[model samples]
Target chain A: MLTALARDLAAPLAANGSFLIKPGVGLMVWTLLVFGLTMVLLSKLAFPRISAALERRQKAIEESIDTAERTRAEAEQILAEYRQRLQEARAQADEIIQRARQTAEVQEREAKERGQEIVAEASQRAQREIEAATKRALEELRNEVADLTITATEKVTRKALDPEDQKRLVEEALREMDFSGLSSGASNN
Target chain B: MNATETGGLPPRPAPEEARIPAPHPTDDPAPKSSVKRKLLIALGVYLAGLIALIAIYGFKGHRNELFKPQNEFKLESWVDLGIFSINKAVLYLFIAAALTCVTMIYIARRMQQRPNKVQAAVEALFRLMHDNITASAMDERMAAKWFPFIGTLFLFILFSNLVGYIPLPTNTENEINVFGLQIPSFSLYAATANLSVPLVLALTVFVSYTVEGIRAKGPIGYLKGLIPGGVQGGMAVPIFFLEVLSNLMRILSLTIRLFANILAGHLIILFMAGALAVILGSAWLGWFTLPFGIILFAFEVGLVAALQAFIFATLTAIYLGGAVAKDH
Candidate 1:
């Protein structure tokens, strides 16, 4: 089959009025003219614009990337600063709370001390007042006891005694009587 | 040579053959069985399709109008004006050139920072030519200088090759009847497939590179630089001549590579699509060859078209770069 096909192809190739390899001057000229014009037109009109556009796009992309990188860096810096400030603020807040707590604790201790001092002073004053009152009540009781002794003597004698003798007798009676226990009781009360 | 010569004993198998093991019992059988069944079904379907085609078209295996050389590659002039005659090749060239210009200019005009799909495609093409082909082969200064020329060459050849694969109504030799009206038959032809087109383009590259070399190095220095630096004395003479020959051969190599590849692809497509069946005079044979034709067509369109253009432009850039380099 191949041999027959070759034979068929070779027959015309050999008999050729026009061969495959044969070149036409007109066609060559047209090709040159067309290609030349195409190259010139493209180089002048189309290629420069395309190249320019490509360069523009490249520049734009590079600029965009640079801008994005710069923006990212700035954002990171700002974030760092904000984080530092926040840390500082937190530290200050902690310091303020600590100082306030210390102040409250000092005030609380002073108040407690003052309350105890006031309570002690009041207790001392109350003890002094109690002593004074007890002394006054004892003096009044002694006077009443003396008056009652004189009345009992008058009723028994049925006559007035001399002042000196009465005084001496009262003195003797007060000395002989066991008034130490009565004085002790009055002091206890 | 027979077994009788071996004293009536069976011949021993070669060592490699003896080492061949039988199928292992542990191997899975389900997938293999399924694959075999699928193959059998495909074969049966292909045979049935071929029989149907034969029944419809009838086997006429004595026809002789299969391959026609003139109809395949010949250019019939539509207009004649001495050396400026317009033909099918000229029309294709004009279309390719115009398309290259319009597309580039249009895309260039509408270019945006964020490209649409079509714009992105165009930009990708531009980058491929600019970076991969041009910049990769030459320095920045040289690439800038010659980018337009090399870029145009790449785009032109690429478009020409791609446009060639499309079927158009350019086959004036054949006609089809459509509702009492006659129209030209559809055929595939690339302007780059013609010898003249690539030859002209190659000549341009050759001249441009030679000029650039001479410009960078003085004419004498350029010619002397063709020889390798290690050679001297009597050896240099032959080596210089050989180097000159090799340099001159670049033009032919560049030209023939593009032309032959495109031409051969088209010819194979033509043969496989219908010519083989037409030659065999069997209607069912066309059904058999059609799938192969489709596959080859897909390959040619998918790979060869762009690859050829890329190689051509890349070689051009390398030549230009080599011409100007201090080492050269």
Candidate 2:
């Protein structure tokens, strides 16, 4: 069956094209024409631009990377600066608090000393008032005692005595009445 | 009598004779498909290669010309271009260029600081080409001068190789006959499958390197430099001949490698479909042959297309490297 079919096979060149293992000049011309056109179009318009675009992409990527690095560095630097300022502010706040505490303590001490001085002045005034009252009371007691002495003298005598004599008597009576103790006590007070 | 009888029906390989594995019988059992994606990819390529081999064998001498009908496995011209000719390969070239042109133009217009999906993919390809081919070979300044040529070569060949995977009209009977003359049509186009395409690419590289070498070292200096100075005696003449010969071989090797790799892959895919048909004895293999062939084909051919383009570009850069180096 294989040989029969093979025998029936038509000559390759019969109304059909050849098995083009050998190169054709027409194909070569076409090849040159198409290839040349492709070359002109590509080199002139496509290849250079495309390759340049690729190179441009690469460059753009590199630029972005560099920018990223720079931005990161700047951000880190800013962060460091903020941290430093925060640390300084915290230290200053601590110092201010300490100074305020010390000032308050000094003020409290001054207030306490002034309060004691006021109390001492008030006590001194009360003492002076008491001394004046005592003096007044002693004066009144002496006056009353003298008047009673005079009355007793007049009652003992039937007729009224002369003023001078009575005064002398009263004076004698006060001198004889042991008033030295009273006088000594009043002087000690 | 099946394609598996390799003794009777080996694939008629291209003149370059790519190494293709024969199709395995079901009795042998199939290799497990569950593995790493990369390994699966490698394995799929291997299997797809076997299928392509079978297909090549089935369509032994399947090449055809547009107007002429006497040869096998050769593509004949449909329209003569004074200096060139057109066929499926030429059609593929036009398609490839238009595809690249439209895609690049779109991508170029739509390019942004933030790229969309298509833009991102194209950009990555550009960077890959520049770094791998241009930067790897020499310093940046010299690389810049040659990058466009190397880069364009890479993209063009890549698109052209990829276009082959499209299912367009190919083979002998698919031609449109007008007044007994046929015009070839192929949406399924693989430009690098044609030898002439790679030849032109290599020749361009060859000329570029030659020009660069002369520019770097004066013309006299370049010629003198080709003959190594360290060797003083009778060895000098032979060494110079050998060096010149190897330098010339760069063009031949560059041309052949690009042409053969993609052609082999394209043929492999063709053969795989044939092998499937032969094995199942039908155009339809109960949802097995075609869908599986397509899945396998996509992965395998896609990888080959990219790989060949890269290799060609890389070699060109290396040539440029040798040409523009400050010292010998």
Candidate 3:
């Protein structure tokens, strides 16, 4: 069977000549025409669309990258600005707290001073009133002593006396008494 | 009877000759033993078949029956119309062209940002041709201008080379009768295997680069630029002539490279498949040769087809780039 097939294959070799190198005019013309038509059709139809799609994808990717970079930068800028503002606010808060503390201290000192001044003025007025009362009591006590001395003299004589004699007697009695010592004792009381 | 009496077909083997020896029926206690017995029987049958083949058709006078290399590449027209006739090669070209257009257009129409399998494959192919072949050789502007031509060339040739590997019913000279209908036998043939196809393509590239060179530099300047730099006086003339000859040789180089590679690959496959057995006059030799044939077929399909296409396109780009280049 194989021998027969081989013989069949071998039969045409002598008559075929050199078909391998021989140029077929029809084949060449067809190749050129077909290749030319294919090239034109592809150039006009398929290649451009594919190239455009690829370019479009490339452009979109670049744009996305650019946008991402810009967004990141803007976010960083905003974050920095926010941090700066936060630091400023903290400084302002510290300053306000410091001022409040200082103001509180000064107010407390002023209040203490005003309380001391009020206490001192009250003690001074009380002392002045006491001194005036002591002086008036001493004067009243002296006048009462003169009247008592006159009554005692009249009782012992068992008769009435003139105004000049009574006054002289009373003066003599008052002079005999230690009035400096009495005034000093009254001031101590 | 011979193939001539059987209308270029071999007579079918008798039932006894075709049948594989059946294994003896076994009543084994274990299934494992049964499986092992079957495997051993299969191996024995294979070895027996090989031995039988060697004994029947030993080394003898069968060299004259071997298929010739030229017969495989013969171009007998299916339809002859004076100057324009359709042959197998022509049919392959039409198929390749149509496939190139349809696939390109279909993928172009359905392109996506995120692609499915087929779309991704097409896109990858596009990028390979555009970036690796066209853009890499030339600058962006030139690549853009010539991408369609170079891309189409690459795709057309690539399809042509690939489809060549697939066996098709185009061997009209050898027909087989099936259900009372005569059908052409299945055979591998490529359009690029023929000299005319690649020659035409190479000629196109040659014309393109030359025109581009002339367009970039005026006619006189383009001719003068062929001389290498630092060349002067009497040396310039010969150098310029050699350079022109070399430039002309690019067409032949391109043509022979594609045509020879594809033709040689197919011939090797044909030889390895059955021609070797026919020459050696041993039918058992086919069993050994078939594996090598399969391996060669794989190599041709996997690497040679795409590689040839890539080289052709890349060379075209280089020529175009060199032609328009300021240094050249």
Candidate 4:
């Protein structure tokens, strides 16, 4: 029975076995050759270039980063100094502006006080001149009015009286004039 | 406006803050925290299940039946031969294929967006195999060339080795009809149960390493490497013979190491699991030996799986590294 089973199994296995081994063995060897050749080509040609490129790239990146870092630090230092200077300048400008504003205010107050003093002096001088002119005009007007009254009275008396009458009128006039001069002198004293 | 007002305050840790300086590593990988709990939990669950099964089998006194070997269901006819060799262990090949396809495809897809835990685990394994194991030994560019072959070998062997510990239905009591007779069958066995499996794997390694060596150093250069440097006429002949012998020995050693480790691990698990029932005769005995056996089983399985994969990858890497040596 075991022999029968073995016999039955053998027939199909035999026919396919040779076919399987032919392809299997050949393909395996071919694949092995291809793989070996590939490894050779890669190790010789491919890998070195890639490895070199990688090393170059890494070095470049490191150098770039170093340069960037140095630049950044320098910029930061410059920024710090600039900020310090800017702050000091701002403070100084504020002080200068404050001083200028204070000086301007003092100058403005002095100008205003000088203007007010000039205005006061001009007003006082005008008042004094007006007072002296008014006094002189009043005295001149009083003397002129008295002379007109005397001339008019002499003309009216000449028309109405003769020569003898006129002489008497003149005598009366002279006596009155002398009394008036005495009164005038006493007032002036 | 202030940090505390928005509830962003640094947490007022309890008095035990001194004991635990940082968060768990699983929670936050920034600091070293004990993964003791999570690892223990995973181990504990595995142990509990394994122990429970062992206790149940032990109480029933089924050791002799469990360990008993009976031949069965082996194909004695031509129907078995095709692209794939049919056997119970070959199911592990399907498991490997399914695991690889599903895992790799799923990982490939998910890695495009977000990697899941299983994918991450697999990717990490692949990365360690490539970067630390392979690339560290050879140039990274050279390592990439050999990554696929070495990576696949590691994954297949690892998964196949691990599946052996799944406690599949592999008892000899199962009967099958063969040649008009009902015979007992060992239903489930480890893929590495047969030496042929690891032998084929080692053969693959042999072919790859030999081919790589021949390629890097030309055929003549490769042959010349067998000769000792600075040897005189009389000494050269003897040294050349020794070198040939050693090269032959390496093939045997690499094959045997992987085959033996996997085979021994499976045998030990079989015996331990089979005899677990007899060892737990008493309640106290069951409590003590059950944990011990289960713990040993779990650790052994995990260790063997990882270690075998590691060794296989390492050996392959070393072989390839030697082959591609420009300065040698």
How large is the C-alpha RMSD of every model relative to the true structure?
Answer: 16.8, 18.5, 18.1, 15.1
Q: Model 1, range B105-206, lDDT digits (tens) per residue?
A: 988888888999998888888899899889988889889999999999999999899989999888877878889888878898999989999999999999
Q: In every candidate, how many clashes are there?
A: 0, 22, 0, 2
Q: Name the regions of candidate 4 deviating beyond 4 angstroms.
A: A1-189, B1-66, B69-79, B82-85, B172-188, B227-235, B276-288
Quote the lDDT for A70 in model 3. 100
The full ranking of all candidates by TM-score, starting with the best, is 1, 3, 2, 4
Candidate 1 C-alpha error for residue A76, in Å: 3.1
Put down candidate 3 lDDT per residue, B1-88, tens digits, no spaces: 7888889999767688458666555644567887899999977876777688878776453655435556666777889876678888
Candidate 2: tens digits of C-alpha lDDT, residues B1-328? 4567667787565554445555566535344433466697876876676566556554333332232322223554667666566655666788887887778767877778888788889988988889977889988998887788888898888888777787776554456777888854443447777788888888778888988899989897776677765776888788878988988898889988987777666544554555435433433331234555576688757687888889999989988898766555
Write candidate 4's Cα lDDT for B187-270 as tens digits: 435555445566566667877877887888888887676675677688878887887787667677766777667655654454
DockQ (C-alpha) of model 4? 0.03
Q: Clashing residue pairs, candidate 3? A: none
Better of 1 and 3 by DockQ: 1
Cα displacement (angstroms), candidate 1, residue B259, comes to: 0.5
lDDT of 3 at A115: 90
DockQ of each: 0.41, 0.29, 0.38, 0.03
Candidate achieving higher DockQ, 3 or 4? 3
Measured with C-alpha atoms, the lDDT of residue B293 in candidate 1 is 96
Writing each residue's lDDT as its tens digit, candidate 1 over A1-189 gives 678868866676567725578887889999999999999988988888888888999999999999999999999999999999999999999999999999999999999999999999998887777667766865665566566667677778876677776777667666766655655664465
User: Which candidate number would show the highest DockQ if scored against the true structure?
Assistant: 1
Candidate 4: the clashing residue pairs are A9-B78, B58-B277
The estimated TM-scores of all candidates read 0.81, 0.65, 0.69, 0.53
